[model samples]
Target chain A: MRRYLRIWRIFFTHSLIQDLEYRLNWWLNAFNTLLFLGSSALVLWVVFTQADAIGGWTFDQALTLLGVYLLIEGVTVVFLVPNLNRVPQYVRKGELDYLLLKPIAARFIVSTRYASVWWVPQLGLALAVILVGMARQGTLTAGHLGLLALMLVAAIGTLYAVWFALTTTAFWFVKVDNVSELFTAFFAAGRFPVSAYPGWVRALLTFVVPVAFLTTVPAEAAAGTLTWGWALAAVGVAALLLALSQALWRYALANYTSASS
Target chain B: MRWRPRASLGDVIRVDGLRKVYRVHEKEAGLRGSIRAFVDRRYRDVVAVDDVTFGVAPGEVVGFLGPNGAGKTTTLKVLSGLLHPSGGTVRVAGFEPRRREGAFLRGITLVMGQKQQLSWDLAAVDSFLVNQAVYEIPDAVYRERLGELTEMLSLDGLLRKQVRKLSLGERMKCELAAALLHRPDVLFLDEPTIGLDVTMQQQVRRFVADYNARHGATVVLTSHYMADVTALARRILVIDHGRLVFDGDLSALVEARAPEKRLRLSLSERVDRADLAALGRVHAAEGLEIELGVPRADVARVAAAALARLPVVDVAIEDVPVEDIVADLFAQGRAARAADAVRAAHEAGAAAGGRG
Candidate 1:
């Protein structure tokens, strides 16, 4: 465990040094975060102008849900997206063998290899947005913080599991970027709470796209109305997905043909 | 069919009946076939690295020679644990390579000429640092090895430069440094000097030799350049059509595959093709220069006869080139392989009929 951590730390430093070579990314990412926030805020204002409440949740509740969505997006963009998406290129180019030959686990090497640190500012702002929403609802209980912590873990783990499971399919279909893009489109639904959508859309988001576990659970945790049952269920489903992805990764390695030299 | 007995005690690497089969998706040549194939995908087994068995004792350097797609790279991959074998077992440094245990991986390294492990966007130094951590090299040891490699590979300025920005030779030098940072006991280098300038190739050769001498590391290398094999390897293993066709000393391989010597003669006058052929098999004849291939046993008689009959100004006898010998080995295998396939088909038919 310590050895893997050391490798991740080294990778983090390597990424920082590499990012320094492209100094313009800081400004570009800042601009990108603002663009995302502006569009989401515009949609929220447009939706609330028509309805006073969205599926029984007031405007502040929906705002917090959007904030949670952005938070997940920020974390994914920072660490997971850039790295997971490169799995296909590595498989196609046969560069994964180098990673496989490493002393550490290949999954660990690929997962934590790249980081876009420029998104840290937006991550902080997303946290502030969640806190502000909680304050407005006057739900500042210690129990709420504990529930939020557990839900956040489940949310992040589930996101990684889905993305990684999709990415690992590259071993069989070397070009699945189109399917990954579809997953991204589904992830956009996380910007709105599942309850705001109709019943069928709620089921699709909860089961098919997993946006509910990603956004709604954490938003409910911040809402102080979250139940222990919901938190445990999210954690259970996330654990199952993580184990499946890990098993798939192992099976993929065993059958890897390693693109000919 | 095995020549050398398996070295069970002292060998750093061992393989017994190693085989790897690839189920390649067959693609069709036309639109109709492509659609049919897409509708119902079919695959065929490609037996790469078929029943190959070999061993390398501690600190031994063996040159693996084979034609393109003759399974040299596949065997190397299996040895390095990148590809698991369909049949047989491989052990390197007393551990199974397929398991790829941390200790086993730390004990071996594979360097492919066309591929690199360096982070392209970062300086080479950053990738080296990554390797250091991944390999769990102590800080003091990492610094010591870095200094040694930087000096050996002439990587003083190259370390800080982005891998993408460096020249091919420069990148290769840094790559070698990265691969050797862990100082693995078993090194599997496939075409390590490919696409390098002559000077760079020579430097790489010398660096490999020096590293081997200092650390006594086992090296298995494959290259198109016979000079590399001749200069470094004491023994050579030749693979053709996914089989080990020849395994012995380099001199023995040349002597066994080529039973003739090259005789180059410069005559006082232009000679007839018939007269040159009379001396021996005419390899080349232009104006006053005539090259002949005479039986190794008859070289003395052929030289004596040529001197007495022709106005010989100069004559030199030499061994056939290793490249020609290896090429001839592969060429011979192609013909023999067709006959073997036919015989195997006949045997299969006969067995089926008998069973019926």
Candidate 2:
């Protein structure tokens, strides 16, 4: 585990250097990220101006959900999204062999090997939104804040596990070029609370796809509506999903007819 | 393919009847099958590796010689634990490759020419640092190996340059350094010198030879370039169409497959095609030059006859190239396969007739 962390640090530093190598690209990508967040914020502002609340949550409460959504999106785009996009190409081109031959766990190597540092700045914008939402809510107890932190960690783990499982489909499904696009389209639902969605869609996002664990539950914890039982359930689900994803990864590795082959 | 030697630390790697099958989706050209594939895909099994077996004794250098799609890469992937064999057994440095334990991984390294392991935008030295962490190389050893490899490969100044900015040869040198950071006992190199200029190729070949000599590392190299094999590998394992066709000394392969020497005659005037045919099989003919293959024992007689009868300005005799010999081997494999297909078809026809 110590060795793995060392590898992860190296990977992170390499990624940072790679981004810094091209100053123009670094600035342009950062601007691109802000433009995207600004557009999302504009959409939220326009919707809130029309109505004080969408479904049960007020505008401030909805912004809190958006903040959590940004946090999760930033995490995904920084690590999981880039890695998932790489897996299919590697599987197709057989580039994954190099990672497989390394002295570390293949999952850790593949998932965290390369970082997309461009998306990390979005976390700042997300924190700003979280602060504004907290100010509107007036106060937050220390216990609730602690629970919120735990929820955020569990949510990120669950989201990463879900992405891993989805990307592992490339091993069995060969032609997964469009898988990421489909996943992104569905994951966009996490920008709003599950309560705002219809029953069936909510159930699908909460249970089948688990986007609620990625955004809504964390936002709920921030809104002081989070229950300990559900938070435990989220942690349990994340652990189970991570275990299942690892099993799937091994199965995929066993069947991976390397591109060279 | 058999593994009677059993488990022993002396033998770093052992392979026993390893097989790999690829279930590739099959689709026809034209509009009909393309549309049908979208509705329902069809697949067929392709035997990429058909019972390949070889072992690397610790500190030995071996070469895998094969044309494209001959399963050399497949066999390497299986040995490195990148791909699971459809059947058979393999052990790499006392560990099952499929398990991919840290010990097994630390014991080996694979260098692929077509794909790069370095971070493209980062400096080559940074890539080495990353490798250091992954391989858990102590700083002292890492520095020593890095210095040695950098000097040997002439990579002193290039290490600080970004990988994308470096030349292909320089990048390959950095790649080699990164691979060797762990001092892996086993090295699998697939076309390590592909696309390099002749001088760079020689440089890499020298580095590999010296590395193997100094470290006593077992190396398995695969390359289309005969020069790479001739320069580095004493023993060559030739594969054709996913099967081990020949395994012996490089010289032995040439001697057995191509016993005859080629003689080229540059005449002042165009030689008659018939005359050349009468002397020896005409390998090639141009305006004023003719190349022929003659038995080694009869080379003197053939050269003497050609000189006396023809307006030969210059004559030279040289051994057949290794590429030509391997090509001939592939051609022969194809012919044999065609013959088997015909024989099988005849048997099937006869059975159908009997049933009718």
Candidate 3:
């Protein structure tokens, strides 16, 4: 495990250096990330102006939920998206052969290979938003902060497992480039409170795709509204999905015929 | 560096009845076929490797020669644990390749000429560091190995340059360095010198030979460039139609497939084409130059006859090239298969006639 972490660290450092090499592109990417967050915040401001409360939450609560969404998006962009997006290409080009030959697990290598450290600033922006929203709501307590941190970790784990499982299908369906787009489409629903959606849509977001756990439940923890049952369920779901995704990754690898065969 | 296999071991790599069949989707080439395929998909099984078996002794460099789709890459992939074999078994360095244990991976590396393991945007050294961590090499060993590899491949400034910015040959050298950072005892190189200039090709060939000589590593290389095979591999394995058609020393393969040498004579005067033919099989005849294909056993007699008959100024006897010999070997394999089919048909006809 330590060896794998060391490998990930090396890969991450390489990505950081590579990103820094393109100074102009690096700044441009940073600008674009801020532009995206600014635009999203603008949308949130307009929505709150139109209504005082969204789905039983005040303006600060909705902003906190948006912050959670941004945080998850930042993590996904930093680690999961960049790596998973390359799976189809790797499968088509047979470049995955090198990963398979490595002494470490292929999944671990592929998932952590090309981290987008350029997104680090975006993650910092998300943290700023979360802190500001918490400060505005006057809900910044130690207990709430601890719970929020735990739920955030669980959410990130669940999100990574979901992305991994989706990308693992690339071994069989080599042209599944749109799979991440599908995830993004569902993730957009997490920008608002899960309670804002109708019953069936809420259930779909909560259980089927679990975008609620990624955003709304973590936001609830931040708001000091999360129940013990839901927090326990979040941890259990994260563990279950992680194991499932790992198993699926193995099964997909077994079916890998490798390119040029 | 930690564990060296005894040199007296019979074979570092062994295979038995290995086979890999790929199920490829077969789609017809039209709008109608595409529409129909959307509703019902069809697949065809391609036999990439068929009951192929070969072995390589310790410290030996074996060349794998095959036409495209003849299973050279597939066999290498299977042997390197990239793809699982559909049938039979493969053992490399006394470990089943499919198992892909840490020790097994630590002992072997596969380099594909068309594919690269280096990170495109980073310096080659960064990728090397990644490999260092993946292979779990000690810091001291990693630095020592990197220093030696840098010196050997002349990768002084190249390590700091981004891989995408490097020249093809430079990138290839770095690829070799990255794959060798662990100093694996077994190397599987598939077209390691493809798309290289003659100089770079020679350099790569020399590097492979030098690395093998230094480390006593068992190397299996596949290449379209016979120069690579001739310069590095003494024993060549030729695969045709997913089967090992020829496996022997380079000279032995040449002798088996083409048991004749070319006798080129720059005659003092123009010699008749018929006279050249009478001497041996006339390969080419120009104004004052004559070339004859003489049987290996009759080379002396043919040369003596040629000198006695024609006014020969200079004579030279050269063996057939390894490329032509391999092409002829493939042709012979095809002819033999065709003959077998014909014989089978004739026997079936005879049996049916006898029953009738």
Which candidate should be chosen as best, given DockQ against the real structure? 3
Angstrom error at residue A18, model 3: 2.0
Candidate 1: tens digits of C-alpha lDDT, residues B1-356 = 22566556778888989888887889888999999899999988898888888889999999999878899999998889887788988888888787889889888899999899998898898898889878888999999999999888888888888899999989988999999999998999999999999999999999899889999999999998888888899888999878988877888877777889999999998767788888889988887888899999999999999999999999999999999998998888988988999999999999999999
C-alpha positional error of residue B273 in candidate 1 after TM-score superposition, expressed in Å: 2.3
lDDT of 3 by residue, A1-261 (tens): 899878878888878877777778767877997898788879878888998888898888888887888889989988888899999899898888898888888888888888888778878888888889998988899999999999999999999999889888887778998998999999999998999999999999988999989999999998888899999999999999999999998788777744345
- The DockQ values of the predictions, listed in order, are 0.63, 0.57, 0.69
lDDT of 2 at A81: 78
For candidate 3, the per-residue lDDT at A153 reads: 98
Lowest lDDT 10-residue stretch of candidate 3 chain A: A252-261
Looking at model 2 chain B, report the run of 10 residues with the lowest lDDT sum: B1-10
What TM-score would chain A of each candidate receive against the reference chain A?
A: 0.93, 0.91, 0.94
Looking at the true structure's interface, with contacts defined as alpha carbon pairs within 8 Å between chains A and B, what fraction does model 3 recover?
Answer: 0.85
Clashing pairs in 2: none
Per-residue accuracy of model 3 over B205-266 as CA lDDT, tens digit each: 98899999999999999998889988999988889888987777887677666779999999
Q: What TM-score would each prediction reach against the true structure?
A: 0.94, 0.88, 0.93
